[model samples]
Target: MRFSLTCLGRKKPRLLASEILKNVEALKTPAKPLRSQEAEFIQAPDLSVNPFFQQLPPTLANFFKKYPPAPFRKYADKPVATNAEDANPFLPNKNPVTGRYAAPKYSLRRQSDLYKAAYRFGIAHLLPKLGNNKKFYEDKHLNKTPVRGSVMFKLTKGERTKDSRIQEVNEALSKADEIIAEHRGRAYRRKLERKSQQTTPWF
Candidate 1:
């Protein structure tokens, strides 16, 4: 009975692990240190190349790749295709590296959105029935945002009159003038010092 090559290989005796260790120990060369700390780094001789293997001149080196000779060139008479014919244009493309056919990806939500968009193009104006665009407000006021919930600033109780605004400005200017006069007055300063001294103890 003829045994298969793999069966014969399996039947063969494997070398003992102890014998391998004994043979390795017989060598005169010292065993390499187990720890990296004990091991000294030695530069490989192959890394330092010979002078003969120095970089060849550009003349000797190939500038462009040579075209590989085709063994079968019997189709030379056949007309070269100008416009390539597609086998299946609708089919999903394959990934070259993975060698797996790619699945066609589609967004259902985007499709639904597109379907929804098809119904509406723009605002449709009914010219004949379009009523007069008469604007109606409870009161005529510019600062509507403040009265509304989106309050950027507080609204005044009543509208300010031109005379009242001018009067307020004049009052403010008079107050400023009075403050300047008080600052320049030596008598006012003396009065202030006496008041402060009376309010607080000397200690």
Candidate 2:
């Protein structure tokens, strides 16, 4: 009697063995390396020659090239109007119907005062303390102290206008600049000390 082996109910004849061997050989062969298949890497684009920078005006483009975005400074020198009433005219006006006071409106005088104040104080931030009260404004001794908001609100508006607002703003700006400069100097000194510590030989 003769016998033949079968797989999945199909008989494989002896003549098909060569084809099966060829398939197994193909599977055994190694694939090409991944590095060989990839393209070479290229360098990043140059930002200085970018099309966007080329389109800007010369002064603005130069500014962008030289400095970072934050903490930009612009300076202006002009005579400040010392007269409080002339500078802040709106302080005098009262609402006739309700008898409540309104802050200075946008008259030419007020605008001039606003410009002067902005220049004196720097445009970024306002002075923290400001006001006019009988205790602060009227009393000669108390006027030396900082004005409180609640007391300032109760006083007649005219008293506030009499005080030299421009001078007050100038004083505030001077104080702020002094404090900023001191802090910055301290920070820079600390940085230098740290650098020295890193480089110096330990005994």
Candidate 3:
């Protein structure tokens, strides 16, 4: 399966790097220090037993399509009591991970094992979701075209302004100032050119 990761935003690159580091750290059991330039591939198996896998969004759906459902027994319709002392009505004997129970019910250690298994499975299942953001950029040449004004420009001028006269005055003044600035710049440039022409050339 192809896997990739895409990150955007001011700090997203750093966050992505840290996440990668964490995943690499999980490989420490093999007694190897992860190098930054190592190959960008990891082997992960789907050990997920959570029934909630089917309910995940499309971004996660692609990852789970490869793995089989986790092995878990469904919870019974009703709690089976061995004795009045053995069963607590509110504290029903059941597996928290599967929301189900076996004959004698799973002990704390068994339940913890199940949880760890679920966790390993969960990480494997989510790898694809993390990698779904990859993309490729295509470059192309396009013909230049005159850009049309926005639809808002079709509205009557007075429709937007409270007083057209005031707006006209402001616009005229703005244009006048622009023209004045241009004239001043041209005058300064001509003065410099004239000064340069008047300079006596030294042999």
Considering every candidate listed, which one attains the maximal lDDT?
2
Better of 2 and 3 by lDDT: 2
Q: After superposition, how far is residue 163 of candidate 3 from its true place, in Å?
A: 56
Poorest lDDT segment (10 consecutive residues) of candidate 3: 128-137
lDDT of 2 at 110: 34
For each candidate, how many residue pairs have backbone atoms clashing (under 3 Å)?
Answer: 0, 0, 1
Candidate 3 C-alpha lDDT tens digits along 76-190: 2245443433242222455545766534333344334433444544543222111112222221123333357653465676776758788888898978745665778877667
Model 1, span 1-203: residue lDDT tens: 88798975666678899988888878856866567533424532321143321342221112101111122111121222322232111133355567665532223342233223322322112011112221123222442335464644345634436678889889989787457657789776676668768856688
Q: What is the lDDT of candidate 3?
A: 0.45
lDDT against the true structure, per candidate, is 0.38, 0.46, 0.45
TM-score of each: 0.16, 0.16, 0.15
Pairing residues by index, what is the TM-score of model 2?
0.16
List pairs with backbone clashes in candidate 3: 75-100
